[model samples]
Target: MFLLLFVVAFALTVNSHSYHRNKYITSANFFSGTIYSWKSDVVGYFKLKERNNALAEENRRLRSLLAEARDTVPFIALDSTVFPGPYQYYPAKVINNSYSKTKNYLTLRKRIGDPIEADMGVISSKGIVGIVNKVSNKYASVQSILNTNSKINAKLKNSFHFGTLVWDTQEPNEAKLIDIPRQAPVVVGDTIVTDGKSTIFPRGILIGTIKDFNLSNNQDYYDVTVQLFNDMTNLHHVYIIENVEKEAIQEIEDVEVKAPLQNRPTESIEETNQENDAE
Candidate 1:
């Protein structure tokens, strides 16, 4: 009789436990879901800045495309050909940047197939940034304009005179434009821009404005100080410029340079002796 009573009591206890479980299951799930959603909202809030930066980059890309469509030019000589859209700009985030040192450098996050390579020009939305020095499959390093070894071709905006842009390792915002012919009119506060003399930068890209100028030591040129547009100490997003015709132009130049030597008649020993005899 005692065993029968114990079995009956155990069956009643199990049924009671099942009833309580079914009653609380819905509430338990609701609470868990609410907590998860709250955590996700917090995470998203913290990511707003990154999202804004990405949007800004996209806008700049659109502007670049529009500019390309408006400025397409036919092929001409290497330097004279207006590269309209010959350059492809790739947006990259500045993963690391520095300007306090004399030789400042920047690192960007980019992949191998992303159209970036060594010697590519880098620029910000406001103005020039740096040039790509090295690249890996997923990253690139840039040599900042603040470097002592950095030199770029620049010119006065209102005239045809051009000069070489260099840094003095003295100030972050100031750079020197040397070799400008003194004949070219120069005044303080005049605009300076890229001369497009090289394959790196396009003509008229704003570099800076003249802060001061003086006759160079050689007295044949003017040395001008330029105040940069972009703040080198603070950089976030940048564009990497890839010249589509760089390789083709380089190949053509190589052929043209080698053609003269290859076609010139080499002087034989007999010819040399005759020339010496004539002298």
Candidate 2:
């Protein structure tokens, strides 16, 4: 009798478990079918939004390319006395950039095809950025004015005692101009600009204003505080300056041609012997 009772109990438990399992599978199937239908309808909406976003991004990129092409084309201004010249603008975008640090750098998407290379200055409609350090066909890197590696000639609004404007990296909006003698008579609000000492950049480009400054305890030069003209942290569009004349100027300066000596080698030796004999 006990064995019969046990058998009946086991049969009931097995039946009960099967019923629950069937019910769970039925509910899950029903719920999943509903969800699938709803997902199909909403999928189109999300995809449309994605497509629009992609289009906008592509449009921005195309416009940037167009501008660069215009600059790179050889264009000579109307001049009666000068030969044909090249005024090229290589377009590039600021893909990555660093600022708000003591040192900063900017990376651009360009290749050797862009013909941009080291020592080329960068700028935008806003203002100057920095010089090019490295370039590849599909990418280029810039040394931002905010970077400690950056060094460029800058001057006061009306004065010509141009030193160098450099990024301290401690402040994004500010840079430092060093080696201005204490006698420059600089005021707190004087403006600073590129002095055009190098062919990479044109003269009179806006830099910043003399916010304030002081002299270091032991240095003869005044440490000037400058407010940068551009918001480098939010760089978007930029132009890689080709300065068509830059290469020619650099080549001329780098030439190792022997200059005529004031005293020839033989003349110098004879003069030295005569002086020694006299002594």
Candidate 3:
């Protein structure tokens, strides 16, 4: 009788567990689904960083192509001992940029020990960005064209009229091209580009389109509002232009500037006395 009772109790316990088997399985499945969802979110978070890096690289490549197209000597082998190119471009990532401030600036990620230096021109695929103002082993700071103190030599894309590009601290998308001759043909859609007057950038590099134009206060020249091609508010990749002959050329130019000042004639003592006597 005790053996029979033990068998009956065992059968009842097994049946009870069997009846609740589906509920137990469902709970386990729910837990597994929650864990899997969390894992997917973690993987996606890491993938976003990879995607950003890839996009930056792609932008650099495209900007390189644009630069090459404008290059007078498009076919250059950098391995050659004597490089004939006046300007060499180095790709950089824009780590930080400021546009809202009156004196905007940009920071680029240049590898440590790179040849980047102050005063180098910076441009994006669309157009000119800024000039390097400071540099370190691993990074460089640029004076944005939108800065109040920033100025660049720019001109009409189809004409020889040139002007000084400056920021009015009004809009990030716009800048002023002042000292342009009023006689120069200008329209709402006329394109502006670098004049190649300075060592910073090559001639014909796109700057922007003329959004509006009016005479200056003195009415001697035109003050044009230019809509930049590159969105100043958003920049990802840029090219740092290194003018290979900058130092040598600057030395020569400096001497030339000082030469005129040093050569000015001094008034002779006798001539001064004669003038005094005449007075």
Tell me each candidate's TM-score: 0.65, 0.60, 0.68
Candidate scoring better on TM-score of 2 and 3: 3
Q: How accurate is candidate 1 locally (lDDT)?
A: 0.75
Better model by TM-score, 1 or 3? 3
Clashes of 2: 11
Order the candidates by lDDT, highest first: 3, 1, 2
Q: Name the candidate that leads on TM-score.
A: 3
What local lDDT does model 2 show for residue 83?
Answer: 42
Instruction: Give the alpha carbon lDDT tens digit for every residue of 162-246 in model 1.
Output: 8899999889999999999978999999999888757777777778999999998889999999999877876666889888888
Q: 2 or 3: which has the higher lDDT?
A: 3
Between candidates 1 and 2, the one scoring higher on TM-score is 1
Clashing pairs in 1: none
Candidate 3 per-residue lDDT over residues 1-279, each given as its tens digit: 999999988876564334222222221133433453455446546567755775687679879977887686766557768786899989876666789988777766665566987788999877899988766555667778988778899999998889999999999999999999878898999999999979899888889999999999999899999999988987766889999988898898787557556756633544674686444
Give per-residue CA lDDT, model 2, range 1-279, as digits (tens): 999999988876564334122212211123433443355446545556644664577578779977897799866555776744544567775656667665566767553467776777888655789877655545666767886757788878777676778767688888899888766778888889888867878787788889998995677778899987787776556777777777687686454223224435556655665786444
